[model samples]
Target: MRWLVNHKQRLIITVVFYFVVLLLISMRKNSMYKYSTETYTMYNISSSLVVSDPTGTFRAKLPVSHAFINSVYYYPTSKSLGENAIAFTMAIDHHSNNMGHHTFNVLGYNSTNMIKSVATAQTEGISRCQYTTMMARTNTLSRLEKIEIESNGVSVEVPFKLARYTAPKPVIICISPQFAAEQWQLFVMHVHAANRFGGHLHIYLTSIIESYFELMKEYERQGYITLDYWLRMKFANPRTPYFEPNQNVEWRNQAGAQTDCLLQYKEAAEYIAFFDMDDILFPRDFPTYLEEFNAVLHANPGKNYLFYGRREHEFVKASTLSEFSFTELVQSLRSSQTVKRGKVVVRPEAYNSTWIHNSKHVSFATSVQVSSPTLVHVQLPVDKNGKRNHSRDLWKIEFGPLIEKIREDDIKAIEEDIYR
Candidate 1:
C-alpha cells in the first residue's frame, strides 16, 4: 500500500512540472519585447493613443511630476544620414530644467511588440524665450505604430499621424502665442500674401481664442492654412519656475515650438520658412517662393537655406479687407532700410533642431544672405499716409472677405430698388 501511494505521488509531480513548462512556452511566444535595462519604479497608467490632434489642433502632454516634456518624435534619419535613428524634441524650461532630470522615455510598438528606449545624443536650444528644446537622437528600427512618451512619472500615448514631403510646396511655420483675436486682419493679410507667393502657413496656436477659430477654419478649408492648437495650461513656463517671465506669455515656449515644427513638418514640406505671423517674407522679382529659393540656391552653391533680410512696415493704406490686398503689402514693402535681423527659409532635413532665430545640427551651415526678399515686420497699424490710428477698428471690420461681399450685394440691391 505504501509503494502504490509513492508511485501516485511521483506521477502527480511529473504532470504538474510539464504543465508549468507548457504555460511558460505559450507566454514567451505572445509576450511584449523585453531587454535588460533599468526601468524606473512605475505606477503604470492606462495606455494612451497615437499623438495627434483630430479636430485640427495640438496640445502639450506633460509629465505628472513635472511639465517639462513637450513631445517625442521620430524620423527615418537614414534618408539624410546613413543609419536608422529617431529624433526627440522636448520643450522644457530653458533656464534650469532644459534637460528635464533625464527621465523622459519613449515606448515604441510594431503591431504587438514594444520597444522602450532611453533618449540619447542631446541638443539644447539656448534662447531667451524662457522655454527651449531638449532634443535627442536614439537609434531605432521599429515603424511608427503607437508611440507613448514618459517623463518623470507620467506616460502619455499620442495618436500617430503620417505626412508627406512635397519638395515643391514650401511651408511657413509661425509659432504663436503671438496671435490674438485682435490680429485677425494681420492674420488674413499674412495668409493671402504667403499663399500668393506659393507658401502654405503651418500655424501653431499656443493660446487659442475662440473668436479666431472660425476664421482659421475658413482658411483651412480654402487649403491655404494648416491650423494646430496648443494648450499652455496657465503655467508661466513649462520648466520649473526659474526664469519665468513676469510680463506677457508670448515668449514662453517659442524655442520648443520652433524645434517641434521642424520635427513634425520636416516630412510634410521640403522647404520651411520660420517667422512670426506679422513678419511677412515678401519675395522680390521671383513670382513664387519656389522660384526665389531656387534662384538663391543657384547663386549660393553648397548652402541649404536662404537667409533673407527684414524691413519694418509702420502702417497701411487701409485695414479694410478689400483695400489691404497682397499687392498692398508688397507696395508698402520697405526694403531699402538695413534690417537688424533676418529670418530663414531652410530645407528641414538638413537640420536636426531649431530655434526661433536659428537651427542646430545643420550638416550644411553655409547660407546665402539676401537683402531683397524682405520679411516686413509690421510694427504698428495706421490709416492713411503712415499715420498712427489708435482708434482704428482693424479687428472689428465685420467678417473680413465674407462681409465685404455682403456689403457689395446690399449696395446693388438698394440701387436697383431706387431705380425701379
Candidate 2:
C-alpha cells in the first residue's frame, strides 16, 4: 500500500512539470506572434496611406476641366540669381498626345512683363502620363512670382517662391518621406542633431499616420523643419507597364525623390547631405556640422564632395529605466563596427545628379575623403530575446548634452501622445 502511494505521488509530480513546460512554450509562441503582427501593421501603416494636404497650406487644387501641373521643379541655371530659370513637369489631359505643344508664361515679380516659353512634351512610362518638362528663363524677374501654363483651352496659374539665398550658414537638405512610427524617437534625435550642427531639415512626407503627422506639423510650425507632402498619384501610375516590382517600387521612388530634392534646393543650400532618418553627421572636434564642414572645405578648397564613412550602432533594449529617460536608454545600448558603406555632403554647384548613396554627373575634379567619420548611423538593434539595445555610446562624446535635452523634451511630447 505504501509503495503504491509513492508511485502515485511521483506520477502527479511528473504531470505538473510537463504542464508547466507546455505553458512556457505556449507563452513564447504567443509573444512571437504578437511581435510579428505589430511589425506587419507598422509596415502597412507607414506606407499605405496618402494625405494630399495635411496642413491645408497648398494652393487651391486645379479645376478638373484643366490639366494640372503635377510636379514643378525650379533649377536655377545661374546660382548668382537664385531660381531665375525654372523647370516644370506638367500633367496634361488623359486624351492628350505626348507630342502636344504648349506655351507657358512666367509673370515677373512686381512687373507686367511675361517670360514666355514653348513647352515640349514627353511620355513618362512609370506615371503612364504624357507630361511636359519645360525650362523657362526670365531676366526681368528678380525672383519667381508666379507661373501660368495654358493648355487645352484652360489656364492654370500657380504661385512660385524662391528659397531664401541669404541664409547665414550653408544648408544641408535631409529628405526622407517614408518614415514609420517606430522611428519617431530617432527622427526627433536627427532634427536636434542637425540643428545643433547648423543644418536645416527639409523633410518630405509620402505616407504617415495622423499622430506622427501632428508631431511633424508641430515641428514645422516651430520652424525647426520644413514639411512637404508627396503626391504619389502625381508621380506614378499603378498600372503602368514600367511599374517596378512591388519591392523595388519604393526603392525607385526614393531615388527619384532624392533627385527632386537635390534640384529643388540646389541653389538655396550651399551644401546638401543625402542621409537616412537613422543617420547623423557628427563632428569629432567641432560643436556643429557647419563648423566641421567649413573646416573640411578650408582644408580642401573647391572640393565638390566630402565623403565620410559611417560607424553603425545597434539598438539594445534597456534592462531598466531609472526614470523613463531616452538619453539613459540610449546610453545602455550596444554598438556595432563601422559600416563599409558611406555618405557624402556635396556642394550643389558640383553635382548635377544624385543616387541613394553617392552623387553622379560630377562637374569638379576634387573629392575629399575625411579620415574619420563625420556621420554616425543608428539602426534598430539586433533583437535578443525581445530586448532592444541602441547605439548611444558612440554619440555620447559630442552629443551627450543634446541627447539629454532631447529626452526631456521628448518626454513631454510622449506624455501628450504626440510621439508614438
Candidate 3:
C-alpha cells in the first residue's frame, strides 16, 4: 500500500496517455469511414469520359456528343475581399435537340486535396446546325482547379487554370478554321493588316495541309500569331451514316473553336473581332481598326457589340490568276451588285457567346450597326466566269501596303504547290 501511494502520480499519467491515444484512434477511424464512403459512391456512380485540351491551354472537350468546354474564366467577386468566381463557355452539338437541363461538376485538386463543386449551366445561344453556346457559373470562393463534367452516363476531366482578369490591350482578333490550306497568301495578308492595326491575331485551324501547318508554326514561334490545331475524326466509310454528319460536325466545331478563342483571350483582350481568312475590316476614317473601334465604343459606350456591313468584290479578268498580289488584286476589283454580310467585334466583358459573324447573348443590349465608311468590309476577290467585279469604292482606303510584308519565299512556295 505504501509503494502504491508513492507511484500514484505516475499511474495517473499512464492512464491519461492511453485515453488520449484511444480518442485519436477513434477520430481517425471515423474520418476514414466517411471519406471512403464518399469516394466509393462517387466512383461507382459516375462514368468517366476522356478529356482533351483542344487549345493546349484553357479549353477542354467533353463527350457530350463531342461537346467542348470553350473557355474557363476566373475573376474575383471583390478585389478587396479576394473572393473568387469562375465562368466558362461551353459548346454542344447543335443536333442535340433535347439538352434538357445541363450541369457541371468541378472537381478541383492539385496534388494533395480535392473538392467537388456543382454549377448549373445556362444556355446563351443556340445555332441549330452550328453550335449551342452555354455558360456555367460558380461563385464558390476557392482556388481554380481541374474540371469534371458528367452528362448522360459520361464524364470528362480537364485541368482548369485562371485567366487574367483583364486584357492588357484593347483589341484581339480571332479567326475560325480555314480548312482551305491553299489560301496562305490571304491568311498572311489578314495577319499583317491586323498587326499593323495594333491588334493581335489568334487563329484556330481544324485541318491544314502539312506545309501550311509548318508555316503557321513558324509564325507562332515568331510571336506574330497564336495558332491552335484541331484533329478531326476520319471514318473508314465516308458514305456511312453517322449520328452527326461531318459537315454538321464541322460547323458546330468551328463555332465552338471561335468561342474557345474568345474565352482563351477574353481577359487579355477587351474587344474580340471575329473575321474570316478571306475578309478584313478596313476603317475609312482612322489609320487602324483599333482607332475606329475606340471611336465606336465612345459613341456607344453601353453597346456590347458592333456589327459592320460588307461590300463584296470580285477579281478582274485581265489579271493572270497564276501569279497575283492581294494588294494589286484588291485595287483592280469592283464591288458586286450583291452585298455580303458583315462581321462583328464584341466587348468580352459584355458578351458571353459569339457566332462566326455576330455576337450573341450580350450582357447589356443588342449590337449597334456602325455607320458606313467608318467600318468597311474588304472581301477577297473571287473569279467567277471570266469577269471579276471588285469593289472600287474601298480602293481609296489606305491599309499601308500590308502585302509588302509577305515573304517572297512564302508566295513562291504557295504558288508552286499543287493544292493551289
Candidate 4:
C-alpha cells in the first residue's frame, strides 16, 4: 500500500481513462450510433404525409388517371381481346448519390381489407431521372408497396395507396340559324311611325339588317325562336341546270324555308312555328308558342304532331283575320277581289318528309308554303298622306268574328320592344 501511494499519479490516470471508456460504451448501446452523417444521410421521402425518420420513406396515395391503363393497344398475354382496363399509375423518385438496385411490388385493397400482390418490377439505373422500373398490372389495380431497396447494406420500404378512378364526359354540338327579313324591317318602321308620328327617320340599311339578325340570334340562343327563308324552282334549262321559281313563287319559297327549319329540330324539339316575312311577331309570341307547344307535347308525349290556330292581321284601315301565314295569304289571293278559301292551316309532316307533295288532291300545299297560324297582321303599305297602297284585290275578305277577337287581343298586349 505504501509503494502504491508513491505512484498515485499513475493510479489516478488509470481510473479517469477507465471512466471515459465506460461512458462511451453506455451511449453507443442506449442512444444514437455516432457515425459521420456526411457520408450517408437518412432516406428523405417526398410525399403528402410527414415522415418520422429522415432516412426512412413512407407511403403516398397514387392519382387515379395515371394509374389506370386507358386502352390496351397491345398486350403480351392476349392477342384478340385487347388489354383489360386498369385503374391508374404510381410514381416515386429515388434521389441518392449512389445508384441502387431495387425491388418493388404493387398491392390492392377493396372495401373489405384484403391485400393482394398485383404487379412487380426491378431497376438498376445510374443517374437522376433514372427511375426504378415501373410495376404494371393488366387488371384494375390501386395500391403499391416499395418492398425493398439496396445500396450500402440498408433496405428501405414504402407503401402507396390507390385512389378512385373516373372517366371524362362527352360533348354536344348546335346547328340552328338566326332569322330576319326585309318585310320585318318595313313593318316595324310603319308601326313605330304610326304611334310616334315623327323622328329623324335615321334608318341605316346595314344597321337595320344587323339589328334584325341580332334580335333573332338572341331569341335563338335562348331556344325561344327561329327564322327561315325558302325558294322553289323549276329547271329552266337542263344543259345549264339553271333553276327559277315561277313568276308567283315567293310564297311557296317561304313555306319551303319554314319546312326546312322544322326538320333541324325534329329529333330534340316537339313543336315549331312558321313566321312569314310580313308577319310581325311581338316578343311574347315566342314564349306563348313555347308554352302552347309544351302543353301539346304534355298531352301527347311522343307523336309526330302540332296544333293549328287562326291568324289575325291588323291593317292600317281596320283589324282583319286569316288562318294563313303571309305566304299562305299570297297563295290564297288571285286578285284583291278574288280569294280562294279553304282550310289553309297545315302541320308539316316532319321536315324532308312532308306528305303534301305526294297527294294529288292538295293544291297550293307543298313544302315551305304550308300551314296557317292563329294570327296574321296584314299592314299593307301606305303613301306619305296615309292612303293605303297596293291593289284592294289582294285583300278582300273581312275576317269572321272569332279571328277579329284574336286580332284585337294581340294589339292590346303588344309591346314596343318587340317592334325594335
Q: How many clashes would you count in candidate 1?
A: 6
Q: How well does each candidate superpose onto the true structure, as a TM-score? A: 0.64, 0.57, 0.63, 0.31
Give the 10-residue window scoring lowest on summed lDDT in candidate 3.
16-25
Task: Give the lowest summed-lDDT range of ten residues in model 1.
Answer: 16-25
Q: Please, what are the lDDT tens digits per residue for candidate 4 over residues 158-206? A: 2322221211101001111212232343444223322221111111111
Q: Give the winner by TM-score.
A: 1
Rank all candidate structures by their TM-score, best first, as comma-separated numbers: 1, 3, 2, 4
lDDT of 1: 0.52
Give lDDT per model, in order.
0.52, 0.48, 0.51, 0.27
**Which ranges of candidate 3 are over 4 A from the true structure?**
1-83, 89-97, 110-116, 123-127, 130-133, 151-154, 164-169, 233-247, 250-252, 316-327, 363-365, 374-420
lDDT of 3 by residue, 1-420 (tens): 011223322111111110000000011222322322211111111232222222313221112244545456665443321256566665544332334356666555545666666766655444444336556666544554555554433455644556555543567778776563545656665665565566767776655544556667877787667765543422222111113223444363565557667666666676888877766665555666677777877888676678776655444332333454544445544543343567788776665556666654453256778656422234444443454345644455333322212334433443333223
Candidate 1 wrong stretches, greater than 4 Å? 1-67, 76-78, 81-85, 94-105, 121-130, 148-160, 163-168, 173-175, 207-212, 233-250, 317-319, 322-338, 360-365, 384-420
Ranking by lDDT: 1, 3, 2, 4
Off by over 4 Å in 2: 1-70, 73-83, 88-161, 166-169, 179-181, 235-252, 317-326, 363-365, 382-420
Candidate 2 residues 1-420, lDDT tens each?
Answer: 011223322111111110000000011222322322211111122232222333323222111212324344443345632345554443232222223333444433345556654444332223332222222223334445566655443344555545344443476666755533345556666666566567877776655544456766888787778765544432121111111122223342454455556656767787888877777665666666767777888988777688877665555433322223445445544444445477778877665445566744453257787766535566664342675344534444221222211233433443333223
Tell me the TM-score of model 3: 0.63
Which is the leading candidate under lDDT?
Answer: 1
